[model samples]
Target: MLENPVLADLATDLPQAVRLQRLAAHLRARFRCGAVALLQLEADHLRPVAVDGLVPEALGRRFAVSQHPRLAAILARGEVTCFHHDSQLPDPYDGLLDTLVGEPLPVHDCMGTRLEVDGKPWGVLTLDALQTGTFGEDARAALAGYRVLAEAAVRISRLEREVQALRTTPPLRAGDDERGAVGGDADQEIVGQSAPLLRLLHELDVVAASDLPVLLLGETGVGKELFARRLHRQSPRRSKPLVHVNCAALPESLAESELFGHVRGAFSGAVTDRPGRFEAADGGTLFLDEVGELPLPVQAKLLRTLQNGEIQRLGADRPRRVHVRVIAATNRNLREQVTAGAFRADLYHRLSVYPVPIPPLRERGNDVLLIAGRFLELNRARLGLRSLRLSSAAQEALRRYAWPGNIRELEHVISRAALKALSRSGVNRADIVTLEPALLDLESNTAVPPAAAGATPARPPAPPPPAGETGTAPGPLRDVVDACQRAHISAALGRCQGNWAQAARMLEVDASNLHKLARRLGLK
Candidate 1:
């Protein structure tokens, strides 16, 4: 019976999500349904929290209650609601069955019971069967009984989480002191509690209230756009539009017209008068991503706009006044670009009035696990797994790996590992899938030395030249070392498909340092 097992699960200290997953899996097995899913009630949609025998994408999908009449009907009922095979309402689970192929065939029967905590609907537990009349009166009664236990489990899980949060939360730091004082909309997307991430958040909070031009300097995939949005949300112009323009994506021919609008007859393709991003973002913010990619002529025009708050449209005699707070972001070193005459110095200075550098994932310590947990939950739903977890060795591997792609890379790694583990375990498997270190495939760029973990030995350092060997042209020791370093970096880059970040990680050096070294060696 589910009574004892559910009671035992609640007594243990497993994570709330894990406990819920177990209950859902148990109910699915107990009813012997073709598929079962546990959905959590969000504001206007139902989020699949756990599932079995559903396609991988089922978890990541949200079903609107209004759109899915069957789900709405089930949620409205106090008892289990059964749907016949010939029901006219479309099934949200169509083409979502894991065992199915090609087009989705109609299910013969389906049953659902709403789970409630304290008289409020929490979510719904659903069962589907390919055979007609699979859920008889007895099965329906049993599922309804299980729903009561499921609600209790969810309630206890929530309470336990609250208590745990209360216990683990540390006293507020100096940075946090002003958080409540300067309250605005909170960004739930930026997830992390590490010191570095916290410091970044504090800096973001400070700069978000001002209208100063901000420059977000960071590696690729460090979520610059998300931070830019947060800055816009906290500013005085929160109610106004926040327009984004990918400067690198803009064509040189259309860059001016795209940024500053154009009247008819401005260019060959110009048919009607059109307002550009600057006009669209007037009185608000304009986020220029990869601003370093702007052409020299566009740079000059951009400088004029920044200086006088005016943009002259293409083929127009008059300049239009605009009040836009610019937030520019780039992974490139603008100072280097300025030195190379690739970027204007004056524009660089203007955009960098408030520079915020986001820390990379490798430097964020345990924040990796915190961020991984968020992705893990999403993967669990997307992969239709009851639970996804990293083994102890896998967790250590993740912590020790150099994530060159930052949070974006970490997410892909976890997702790939989860999918790999799922496929290996088979379609009908119903246990918590634990991802081991081997599945992470992080050996190529792991920051932790393999010797420490008794894994494969690292490559030996490059040997010194033979005692009697003479160079073709001898130079200073520093020059010889620089030449050798350049050659080694070049080889590493080639092996890594010309990825500088990966080459840097492989060489046990910072990516910026590698770039500077390459530039000094005249190899850039």
Candidate 2:
């Protein structure tokens, strides 16, 4: 009747994101279901704009309609689409329901209804339950009846955005087809809404309007390349090619020729004339990744190109004008490099006109959960598991640990953890898997979230040298040492059930030190 608390918030001036989130939560509560997801159709994919009873990373997922038959069937129908238990179509969220812990159980019921706003197809609202008959005739009628209210909620949220966009940004031209919470390549979207990330996005938006050379400074694996892509896509030259070059990957001998084309026979392998990255990116942007790795000789030429908007091919007679915008990025401290004389001072100054320091994963607060959710989905799909989620303890371990490797490290950790969790015999893809701190295998010490350092589990003392394994008189010293190191690490790993961090503690050494030693002993 639109009088309930669920629909009341639609009239409130809540932020569009908050409003959609609340709508999903209310829908879950109202339906008494396991999870509720509001997916916005972007191109051919269904992106979850808001979700309740889902692991945090679900927001980062983009479900292709072609892959999820249930979603596709729902999208095709104006009426409520119900997939009762035993329906042949696989549920898009097999093991993703937040309620399923330990092992995955088959989801019993799922139903969805299409949402339309302003006479146009909007998206869809889906509800899932772990119990059969949850979406019976009454439930189906209720969903269909509430469909209008759901559509209204979306309509209200959309209008709010349109109004704001009208005030701050230009109107979307006709046929731009820009509607809903979806746009851009789904893979390219940044996931979190943390204050620091929001602030950075705002700053990037401002900088993207100009043609200034931007230097992205951050630790490795912090997604510097992703940020550069976002900047280029946001800029005026979005339609033009955004050429990427890894200065560090370029061979020292070919570095100049790579960045500034080469004439025929410029070098031994240069059989024909070729355009460099800058020329390839003409009328657009050239992304120079690991810019600090550029050799000193190349730095001078790069400085000239940035200043004069011109590049000369190696062995060419003269330089020619080329309109290109430079967006350079590096993990190294350019200022320190300049001070140390490894990088040219003038080039450093020119490139850092607008330096953007990308914050590491640890700084983004609960964003870790959101990002982890994304990874969880990916792992779930990859491992063919019905559901994969982090146990509360595992999530705490993630939050506590310093992400030295940043997002790259996080991706590796999640992927590895999923595999380890699934390594158990008889674990089925239909079974839900919960990742505990043990499975995460994070450095027990480093993975401990900040302020929780004392929470690390203490190891049992070194077991009295294994009841007779005293420093023995073995053969060659190097041979003996290697054999002993390998055996000891192996025994520790076995006792700890293959947890390296746990084994490190049992050995009474730092986890990193243990890793290095293991590698040296061929025990890793």
Candidate 3:
């Protein structure tokens, strides 16, 4: 019975996170359900705290009470709420299940029980099964019996959190953070659980509460904008507006007016007096994407606003004070720009009060799959496919390939492969579609061969050195970088029997300046 295991867990001094995850997994096993999720109620949405069988992105999703009728129905009652297989209301887990068959889930039995802690709504426990009629009266009663244990688990988890908070003053837990919020969109959520991602999220959570000007530093397509929004959400100004400005997309002629507003006749396009992004984001966050791309003149004006929380309209007589928090992002090296006199030094210091470096996708091991699951579901729904899954080879291919384009590149790869899989060999949309390595279109351009997609190197490869000293990659940002980052350049050299020129050729470089570019990437 769950009584023994649940009671034993309560007795053990387990960490709060471990306890909740165990509870979800145990419940799924107990009921023999296809999936189990424990969702905590945060304001108006249900956020998954622990999930046993849902997609990786499932944890990142927030189900608004108004949007998800089944969840709302479950939360409305104290007892177990069973949605029979035939119920018409939508199931949010549709097309997101990772089953043994992995076919599209047709009719399924699903049930959930609402949980409360200290007289407040805490969360809900949900179970789903592939077979219809899997949830009978007995199952309902069993879930009802388990509800008490679930609530106890949550209550104890809460107490543990309070205790831990007093000890460490912790950041928002990953499962509870709404970088997933997403504005209620699942795609916007920060979707990974790697140590790098968790560490970054924790740092962001702590920094978000402050009024400091946060600068997000990362490669292109690292979702810096999403992190900026998360900082806004975690800050005191969440209820206020979050205005996003793409400095790179703005014209140099109009950049100043666009950011600081303009009086009529200030420029050709200026028609009337208007407030700029600072005014729009007053009492909230103003995200400056590609801030390095801002014109030098505009950067000076931005620095003024950052110094005094005020914005002066172009052609206006005086500056008006505004209370706005700035969160800036850039893929460019502002320090180098400062030294080169292209970017202002004072502006760079003002924006980078707290710089958070988001790690690249390759460094976030196994997180690639979780992110792939998200895109897979999106494509599945978009393509009207019953199911879309990665073959083991395709998944390995995804992992081994150096994702220089980062998340954006991965999105394109998945979308293109989904389409290719649909058109190739007359694969039916009604059937389960498994994407193979060839469909991914990665190996030809990437260093990893399709034949050895998942193979491990025989020995521990030496740390990669600079790329310029070795060879120049004739390949498009691959061969050299991918070999260095994913595989080892020394291993390539080893394969060439310690021949530098041969290794350079194998890495697809010019073999002249192969070992320097990596130093630019902080690799020694």
Candidate 4:
């Protein structure tokens, strides 16, 4: 039935792999009486890629590929195969399926089929019936029909394989995968498995399930604010608005009014009754970034509201009650700040009730490349590049670079690379784009030596300049201008932690102008 072109197109066009997996699951309903499971063959094992009639937690388990004799026999022949428990199936594979599933897969009730393409095993489709002697010749033939549908399903939903590949990476346990129209995969949002990050995410999961205040501590660009917003999304108050206030951005004169709201005539230029962030986030979360930057006097008032869940508008006689979950974040060393008398210790303690510390990207081995790939995929789409791949040389450079700015740096580099590739016609397919050499050379000239920070980054010797292009003849002012332009763009990017927006702002130019410069300079 899936071979009908209409059904095939619909399945192929489903934007998400989970949806396609669910489509494959529809076969369980078609077969009526048998449990169905789709298994993808990985390098060393067969894993449950998608399934129906299994317990929820069992959806992601793995088993040895060699554990099933019928599977071995079927794979060897590249054809449909069957087994009966009453037939005393041979050693190693015998009783293996029962052990794998934690139940007896009755001989008379089970049949397995291989999903092969070009005579190679891609996956397996297994169906099980509860009744003894339930599956006969006709039933097996129907299963053959289902297997045909399964192959079509696989071809139609190619991205399902990508999703399965992603699942093999141990997923973050912090937030549930957001699969609805209103949200994307929350798991993809929080990406890491380092011991510190994993523990932090587990704690985040617990905190997200509650209405308590959560404080996040990390260095700049470590994604503390992002995590604060993620907490809001996973909470019961997700339907409500999440209001953000950069405590450090507020002026000392206006900080109180900005947070606690103000009544008409409350202070100088207080012309009207204005609701504060507390009011704006009533029933939701108030994410206060740079919480440590909040002044001392303002801290007392903030603590009062956290304790009482009520705020008194400036110049207002009565206090108004508000329901808001506060998620505070800071890049500063709050404990030290509190010790030094800059931050209020009591307020610091209150905000630090359940603190989560995010690790820097350099510490997340291999994740640097994962994040880079994600950003590349996004920027490639945004920039309208049809096909793009990171050359091995580029990948090596990326892995070697110490990402001080973490995920943010990866995003900028990918965006820069994509823009560079789009503008330069042949760079995308080359063994190594010229951009990397430029980037490396620029780094050699401008990068602050790690020795200054008392550490050194091991770097590969940069590629030599192209033949006949190394000699710098004294020439027109245009050559000098071109060299100056390349140097400035690379420096600005490094200084801004690879943030295009910030670099553009610092250069007093628009982002498009910076993109043009980056393209001309080949600073990918």
Q: On residues 1-524, what C-alpha lDDT tens digit does candidate 4 reach at each position?
A: 44464365455556434544665467656655446677767554555556666433233234345544554565555445666546454311111122234442332456678887555678787766554665678768877776766776666566565575354333324453443112544223655435677677656756787776778866455677667766776666766778889875677788999999999999788899998889988878899987866778899999999999999988999999999989998655667666667778888888888887777776766666555544544554455443333544565676676654456646656676566555765554322222343432223323221121111224322433444586754433544555555555445544543344555777789766766655444332
Q: Estimate the lDDT of model 1.
A: 0.73
Q: Deviation in angstroms for 519 in model 2? A: 16
How do the residues 441-523 of candidate 2 rate in per-residue lDDT, one tens digit apiece?
Answer: 66422321111111223332232233236764334355444545655665565454334555678889986687667544323
CA lDDT for candidate 3:
0.75
C-alpha TM-scores of all predictions: 0.55, 0.80, 0.71, 0.53
Q: Could you tally the backbone clashes for each prediction?
A: 1, 11, 18, 1
lDDT of each: 0.73, 0.76, 0.75, 0.60
Ranking by TM-score: 2, 3, 1, 4
Q: Write the per-residue lDDT of candidate 1 for residues 394-441, one digit (tens) a residue.
A: 768878877655777677678877877877736432455667887776
Q: How close is candidate 1 to the true structure, as a TM-score?
A: 0.55
Query: What's model 4's lDDT at 480?
Result: 50
Q: Is candidate 1 or candidate 4 better by TM-score?
A: 1
Best-matching candidate per lDDT: 2
The alpha-carbon deviation from the true structure for residue 516 of candidate 3, after best TM-score superposition, in angstroms, is 30
- Off-target runs (Cα >4 Å) in candidate 4 are 1-182, 185-188, 192-198, 425-524
Candidate 2's displacement at residue 100, Å, is: 9.6
lDDT of 3 at 326: 90
